[model samples]
Target: MKIAVIGTGNVGGALARKWARAGHRVTLGVRNTTEFKGKELLDEKNISVAEIEEAVKKSDVILIAAVPQATADIVKLMGNVSGKVIIDAMNSVRTKPDGFNNSFEALKALATSAEIVKCFNSVGFNVMADTNFNETIADMYTAGTSERAKEVAKQLSIDAGFENCYNFGGDDKVALLEQFALSWINLAMMQGQGREMIFKLIKR
Candidate 1:
């Protein structure tokens, strides 16, 4: 899959490396091609950097890990995303997009032509970097109105070494998924569980 990753932060950087290692063509989209947060990612095979618009234009999927408040501006810079899959990996726990409750809501209004899904926001970047814990691997969760987008996210999750990508229903569950991420934050940070914790589902 040809994927464009916006925001070169820890989350984006980790995923880019993982996907590249998994044989996916990962493009790091940024405002400046020469200098960015994860410039070292360029050394990885199947990973390259490009300006935001160019990267978005060429990729089939776009993973947005940018700051919440920058959601609107980033979508605007993406140009026409018609028939594209947009995986929103941002959370509004700290700040939200201007005039929207969260990044997903903002994308719903602005990037209407794209299939949007909320994913890769439930865990910390370190957890994303390495999902394995002894013999068990971590699971991922996603929520969105578009089944197509959700499937895309699921495969990407697997590519990134997650054990599974569980669906959290549809668009209505989007906010709920963000809250679930807050639950992880509350435990890992607020409750002093540290960052090594992982969310998993077990059934008989």
Candidate 2:
């Protein structure tokens, strides 16, 4: 799978590395190719850097880990994303994109032609980096109306070392998924529970 990572921050960097190691072609899309948050990622095999539009054009999937406030601008830079799968890994915790409730909503409105899903936003970068916990791996969650996008996200989650990628629900559950992410943030940061912990589901 060819993936375009639109943020280059901790979350984007970690996933890019994981996907690259998993034999996926990863591209870091940035405003400035000369300098970006995760420039070191270019040194990894199967990972390269390109301008926003170029990266988007070359990849089948785009992972957005950028700041929530820049959602609109990022969408504009992505050009036409028709038939493309977009995985929004951003949360509106501190701030949301102007005129939108969250990144997922903003992307849905701006990139109307793309299949959007919310995933990778419910866990910390460390958890995404290495989902392994003793003998088991962490579980991933996603929510969106596009079954195709959800399937892509689930496979990407598995590629990133997660044990399973559970479907939360349809588009209506997108906000709930973000709230679930907030719960994790509250526990890990506000409650001082640490970021090493992750959420998983068990059944009989």
Q: Distance (Å) between predicted and true CA of 149, model 2? A: 0.4
How do the residues 2-121 of candidate 1 rate in per-residue lDDT, one tens digit apiece? 999999899999999999999999989999998799999999989998999999998999999999999989988999899999999999988988899999999999999999999999
| Shift in Å, residue 16, candidate 2 | 0.2
- Count of clashes in candidate 2: 0
TM-score of decoy 2: 0.99
Assess the local accuracy of residue 161 in candidate 1 as a C-alpha lDDT between 0 and 100: 95
Per-residue lDDT of 1-204 in model 2, one digit per residue for the tens? 999999999999999999999999998999999988999898898999999999999999999999999999999999989999999999999999999899899998899999999999999999999899998889999999999999999999999999999999999999999999999999999999999888779999
Indicate the residue-level lDDT of 97 in model 2: 95
Q: Name model 2 segments beyond 4 Å from true.
A: none
Which residue pairs of candidate 1 clash? none
Query: TM-score, each model?
Result: 0.99, 0.99
- Local error of candidate 1 at 80, Å? 1.2
